[model samples]
Target chain A: MLLYCKDLTKKFGEITAVNRLSFDVKAQEIFGIAGPNGAGKTTLYNLITGVYKGIGEINFDGSEINNLDPHRICHKGIARTFQIPQLATSLSAYHNIKIAAHFGNEKNRVDKKVIDDVIAFNGLRDKQGIVADKLSLIDKKLTMVAAAMATQPKMLMFDEPMAGLSPLEIRHLMDLFKKINEERGLTIVIIEHFMKVLTELADRLMILENGAKLCIGPPLEVTQDKRVIESYLGNCYAESK
Target chain B: MGHGGNLMKIKKDLGVLLAVYGLLALLPIFFHNNMSLMNILIISLIWAVVAGSWDLIMGFAGIFTFGQIAFLVIGGYSSVIFCKLFGISPWFGFLIGGIVAGGAGILVGLPCLKLKGAYVALVTFAVHMILEPFLKSDIGRAIGTGGAQGILTVPPLKIGSYVYNAMEPTPWFYTLLIISFIAFFIIYKVVHSMWGYSFIALRDSELFAQSVGVNAFKYKLIVFGISAALTGMIGGVYANYVGMLSTRILGLDLFLILMVMLVLGGMGRFPGALLGAFITMFISESLRYFDTYRLIIFGLLVMVLVIKMPQGIIGLIFPLGKAGIIERTILHFREKKAKKAEMIT
Candidate 1:
């Protein structure tokens, strides 16, 4: 397993956000997670990336990474994008990528070429000089993803990357994700709501109902699980299909 | 790549700064006989060092500090007390003062930097409040620290056989100018380095910067320590220059004045500290004839400047690709010229 979470649990005051969740992701695998609203999907990503500390052990690539800082976790080869794009909004798109490159590169030297390449890969060549705050929502998301890629992470996590994107934009992102996984050999974990998109991309899928796992299997099998259908998919979703 | 172009721009900016420094170097020669004018310039230069140090930690690193004046007090008393009690040379006092102040900085900064934003400011403020009373206490008086009255006379800076005195203000002026320039230059290099970039990155977004591997606490401690040392070194020099040590050096008024200079010049810009210190000091001195009403006028001026031109004097000259009064005036002239051209057409 490239990443393992063993009985990870998180509670905020009186509420349990993540309840004893255990999972394993193989090297270069595309793992997808789907759940209804307030299902603790984002909270799980927070624990893995070291943004929030949970009760159980989180091992990444053979090392126990539960105690690491966010930057240390990133240096250890896990990078993630926020649910709402977080960037140095006052800086130019090119500069944002440069900062990430400086921090992400294992070596002390910063390769300007890597920065330029990431900008081009994100199709932000024209908007490179513009400040991040002025960029459209789609462009902001693209810049953020490009910055995360600059970190050279072996494992990349996305939190609802398709939330506000149009259908055409979503298709473009799907193609990009495919290229990133197949060509770059990066392990990806995506928390998304659109079931059709997850069925097309993810090899294995998990369904979470509140903070607990409902089912985990191949995408087709998990989607058709009786408990998931009744609790999450609902009678209307079942009847509409 | 546009690397060469960026290099050229840096070289050009360096040349401009060098030209400004060169003009300032020639100032002593022109004011050799004018004691009052030369005195004002020397005081302004001292302030340039202190304000520039403040700008380093607060402006560049985004560490809010109010204990800078405490460093100044530590520097002043350490140097003066050493020279008076131990018969140490004022020259050696400079080094001792800086080291002690820097040590105090580490002592304060290490624990305080763990607290962010207003909390950091409050800790530094506490340092100042504590130092002020300590300097005025019976323990301080027993040691001949002079308390509120301050040290009346101290040895002047001497080179080989010659002592610089009031009669020879020229040497004092040149000495101060050189020291201030060196201090400002060191600050400029730090502000442009990779460490400086990390400081800015953390300032922009702490969480985002941390995710990218910038250690916020370590950088804050480093900035605070270095800035305190610089301010302390200048404080030692100011003490020897005036030939006195006083608690007023750590007073709230001096702190306010230094802050005003930094704000009037522009924050975060290296040259802004120098410009702000000199211009504000010069204006304040020139208005001294106003006596009682001078402070009121100064307050009004600062209020207007803060509201209308928050970026300071440097912002007026170079507005970061934004328009200024000069740019606006030029555009106005161009518009008039275009109207005339339209009539002809």
Candidate 2:
């Protein structure tokens, strides 16, 4: 396993956001996580990335990372994109990418080649000079992805990468993800809502309901499972099929 | 085309910055032996150095410290006490003062590392105010702080035979001008470096910065150390220049003046700190003729400026919203002309 989480749980006052969740992601696999709103998919990502403290054992590339700081976790080679596109708004896209490149390097150096390659790969070459806040939503998302990729992580997580994108934009991102996975052999974890996206892209799928695991299996098997269908993949999804 | 224009704009801005600094460096030549004017200039330069430091931590790094003046106080006392009791040269005292102040900065920054926004500001203000009473105690007096009466007969900078005394403020002015220039330049370099980019990134979004591997507490401490060190050095120089160190410096008035100057000149810009310092000093000195009314008038002025021109004087002059005023102006005209030519074609 490239990444492993065993018995991870997060609680907020009276509510448990993630409860006894355990999963193992093999190397170079595109793992999809799906659930209804408030199912703690993002909370799980937070726990894995050390953004939130949770009762868990998180091992990334054979190292314990549950107690590591977010930056240290990033240095340990895990990078992620936010659902809302957290970017340095006033700075140019190139500068935003450059900051990440300098910081994420184990040698503490900025690699110009990596910055340019990431920008070009993400199709932000033309908008590289534009400030992130000024870029369109698609471009902002691209910039965020480019920034995450600049960290040179062994594993990358996307939090709803298709949330607000157009159909064409979603297709473009899917292609980019496939390209990245195939070309670089980096493990990918995607938290998404679109059933079709998950079925098409992910090698294995994990479904959650109210922060507890509902099912974990092949994408098709998990989607067709009775509990997943009843709670998340509603009758509409089954009828569309 | 846009990339080419941005490169041109950056080059133009650099040239303009050099020109501005060059002009300021020539101030001694014009003022010559006008001791009173030179005294004002010296004090203004000191404030500029200190305020510029504040700008780096508070404005750029988003630390929002209100107790920056405390570093100056610590620095001034360290130098003056060392000069008086230990017979150290004022020149060496300057270096010691910076180190001492930087140490104090680390102490102050540790508690502040976990704080954010107004809480940081309030805590810093508390630290700034807390030191005054401690210094006024009998132990503080015995330690050469001179209690509430302040330290007297602090020796001026002496090299071989020459003493930069108040009788001739020319040497003092030149010394302060150079020191202030160095402080500004160092800060400029820091804000422009990769570290500076991380500062801005953290300022904008701490989560984003952390996710990308920019350690928040680490960078904040570095900025605080640099800022406090610079300000402390200025304080040490100011003590020698005036030949006095006082508890009066711990007052809210001095700290407010620093904030007003920073806000009025625009925070986050080095030139803004420079302009704010020089202009505020000039206005305060000119209004010193009014005696007691001087402070009230200054307060009103700050209020009006804060309300009317929150971007400060730098914002008004450099409406382009970038760093270099002169270069931004040139770029503005060049772009306009380019657009006009395009229309004609």
Residue B336, candidate 2: C-alpha displacement in angstroms: 11
Candidate 1, residue B292: the lDDT equals 73
What would the per-residue lDDT of candidate 1 be over residues A1-241, giving only the tens digit for each residue? 8999989898999999899999899999899999998888998988888778889989999999996778888888888877787776655676667777887755645788888888888888888777677788888888878888888888989899998999999998888888889988999999999887898999899898778888998988987788988878877766666
DockQ, Cα level, model 2: 0.61
**Candidate 2 chain A, poorest ten consecutive residues by summed lDDT:** A125-134
lDDT of 2 by residue, A35-144 (tens): 99999999999999989999989999999998898999999999999999898776788888988999987678988899889988998878888877878999988998
Q: Write the per-residue lDDT of candidate 2 for residues B121-231, one digit (tens) a residue.
A: 999889888889878899899888988888877876876798767787777777776788888888877877877778889988888899998988888888889999999
Best by lDDT: 2
What is the Å distance of residue B17 in model 2 from its true position? 3.8
Q: What DockQ does each prediction reach against the true complex?
A: 0.40, 0.61
lDDT by residue for model 1 (B1-345), tens: 222433443464456467768888898777889999898889999999889899888877778888988998888788878877888888788877888898899889988866888999999999999886787888888877787788888777899899989778889988988888888888877866656666766776666666665566777778877888888888889988888887776755577678778889888765788889889888888887998777677777778877987778877876654676767899999999999999999
CAPRI quality level assigned to candidate 1 from its DockQ score: acceptable
DockQ value of candidate 1: 0.40
